[model samples]
Target: MRFLPFTLFLFSSYSLVKAGTLNKGDSCNIGDNRLQAGTYQFWSECNSQTYCGSSGKCETRGCRKDDFPFGYAPDDKLPEKCPKGQFCPDEEDQCQQIQPVGSDCQLNRDDQCEGPPNFKELADTSGRGLNVNGSVCLNSKCMWANATLGVACIVENTPYTAYGVDGEFIDIVSRGNCQLGLYCDAAQKVCMAEKLFGEACTADKECSSWNCLGSGVCGVSESIPHHFAIWVYIVVGLGIFGGMFGTLFGLYWTHRKQRDEEREKRMQYWREQNAFHQNLLAMRETARASILSLPGNGNSSARSTLYSRDGAFSDDVSAPILPNAAPKVSGLRHYLADDGSSEFDDGLMMQSGKKVDGRF
Candidate 1:
C-alpha cells in the first residue's frame, strides 16, 4: 500500500516532464509512442482491428475477429438462436450480435449487432499512458478535453503553443487571450513578453511602458522638468545682461579718454600763445630805453640845423659854423621817437682851403 503512493508520484513526475516537452498537433504512431502532443488520447491496431482510447496508445481500430460472439439487443419478442460462429453470451443475453468481419452471420440488418465499443475499454498497445485528468466522450469516442494556456493545440491544421508540436516552431500569438505582461505576436500566432526600453519595436502597444521613440525603438518620453527649464532660462538671461553691460562700459571708457586728449591739446595751444605775447612786450621795452638815451634834444640846434650852400655864404668869414662838424651831404639825418616815427636833420658844410665850416 505504501508503494502505491510512491508509484503514483513517479508516474505524475514523468508525465509532467513529458507533457512539458511535447506541444499540440504532433504526428505520432501507435507503436512505441506516448500520448498525443496536446491531448492524452492513444490509438493502436490489434488483430487487424484498431482500438483508440482517451489515454491509451494503440495501432489498429474496430472489434477483434475472435470476440464476435457478442451481439446487439434484439428488438423482436421471438426466441432467436445464436448464429454458427457467434454465441449467446450471458453478459448480453438480450440478443445474439453479429459474427466477426469475415464470418457469415447471414444477418442483413445493422441492428443485429451492438454499436462499436467505447475507446476507453481498449488496452494500451504502446504502454505509454499518463493518466491524464480531462478525458471525455467526443463524438462517441473518448479523447482529451479542450486546450488551454501552455497546452499544445492544432489550429487550422497547424501546430502552436508555448512550445511547438509536430516539429513546428511556435512563433506568433493571436489577440484577445494573452495573459498579463504578454502581447500577441500575430505573425507567429504566439504570446511573447512585453518589450522594455531601447528594445526593437514597431509600435507602442508592444512595449510594457507605452512609449516608442522615433527611431523605431521603445523608450521614455522626451520632456524636461519644470525646474530644469527655469534654470536654462536664467542662464540665457544672465548672458544677455552681461553682454550689454560690457558693451556700455567699453563705450564710456573710450569717450572719457577722447575728452582728456582734447583738453590737453587745448591747454598746450594756450601756453604757446601766452609765450609769444610776452616776447613781443619785452622787445618793445628795450626799444623804448634806447630811444630815451639819445644825445640830441627834441628841439636843439641839431634838429634846427639848416644848410646854406650858396656861393656867397661859402666865401664869407662871418658865417657861424660849428666846429668839428662833418662835411655836408645832400641827405638828412633820421631819429626815432617813442611814437615810432622818423625825425630828419639837414646841415650844410663849407670848405675853404682845409678850414671846414658847417651851418645847421
Candidate 2:
C-alpha cells in the first residue's frame, strides 16, 4: 500500500515530462500580468504556430515575420506575408487594418499607415506601377508625403526596439520618417537632399557619397580606385623593404667593424711576439760570436792556477767571458794583456812561438 503512493508520483512525473506544447484552443498562462501597458510576456507552453491570447488560450497568429522577426513562430504554419489591407503590429499576434491618412498612429509604425489610393496612377508613366508612395507615421500620426525639400518635416529620433522571442530586449535601431530619396535633417528639422562628397554631414545616411567621416564630412565611397590602391600598396612595400635593408646593412657593418678590429689586435700581438723573438735571436748570436772568438788550447795547469789565484775574472778584463769556456783557453796571454801587465812579454811570446817553460 505504501508503494502505491510512490508509483502514483512516478506516473505523474512521467506524464508531465511527456506532455507536448499547447496547440490552438489549448489553455495557457505565462504567470505574469500582461494586461499592463508596456508589459510583454511569452507563454512557453504554447506552440510556435499559436500564441497565448488575451482569452488565456492558445490561438492562431495572424502574422509571423512582422510580429516575431526573431523566430518566435513556426515558418511553415505562419503566413509568408501580411494581407494587403492590413498590417502586423509589434508584439501583437493579430493583423490590424491599415489606418487612413491623418489618423492617429504610433511612432515608428509606418507599415500600419495606408498610402493614397491613386498614388500609382498619378505618378509619371516611367515611374508608374512602382511602390513609391510615401505614407509614414510621423509625430504619432499617419501622414502623406507633404514635406518637400527645404521644408519643415518631422524626424522621429526615437530608436525602434526589437525584442527576443521571450519578450527580452534585443536591440534598438534609429530610423528617420522621410519620403523616398530624402532624409530628415535632425539639426534643421527639414527635409534635405543627400549631401555629396566633401559636404558636411552628421550621419552616414545623409550623404549620397555613402560614407561620413569622423570629421562630420561626407567622404568617398568605401571602394578605392584600383590604381590608387596599387600605388599605396607599392609605397608601403617599399617602406618595409627599405627598413629591412637598413637593419640588415647596419648589422653587417657592425659585424665587419668588429671583425676588422679583432684582426688588427691579433696582428699587433703577433708583431710584438715577432719583435721579442728577434731580440732573443740577436742576443743568442752575440753570445755565440764572443764564445767563438775565445783562444783555445790552454794548458790545464796554467788555467787552473790563474782561476785559483784570481777567484774570478778581473773587472778590468775587457774580453767577454763566455760560460763553460774556461777549459778552451790554452794560455794566459789574453788575460795578462787585459790586466795591464806583461803586454810586451805576451806579444813577444806570441811572435816567437817558443815555450818559456816548455809548455806555452
Residue 139 error for model 1, in Å? 44
- Tell me the tens digit of each residue's lDDT in model 1 across 24-134: 233333354333433222212221122223344332222222233222234523235455434442212223444332233211111222323432432222222211122
lDDT agreement with native, every candidate: 0.38, 0.55
How does model 1 score by TM-score?
Answer: 0.26
Candidate 1 local distance difference test against the native = 0.38
Clashing pairs in 2: 297-330, 298-329, 298-330
Tens digits of per-residue lDDT, candidate 2, 1-360, equal 000101112222222232227888988874531322222222246665666777888777667534334334364554555678777654347778889888986544566778766555422222211122556666678876555677887765432223337873422222344445556677788888878899987766577654678898888866556355788989999999999999999999999999999999999999999999899767755754564455653333334333333244323444555575644333544543454543123311233344443444
Per-model tally of clashing residue pairs = 23, 3
Worst 10 residues of 2 by lDDT: 1-10
lDDT of candidate 1 at residue 295, scale 0 to 100: 50
* Candidate 1 residue 95 C-alpha distance from true site, Å: 81
After superposition, candidate 2 runs with Cα above 4 Å error: 1-48, 66-76, 117-132, 160-178, 221-360
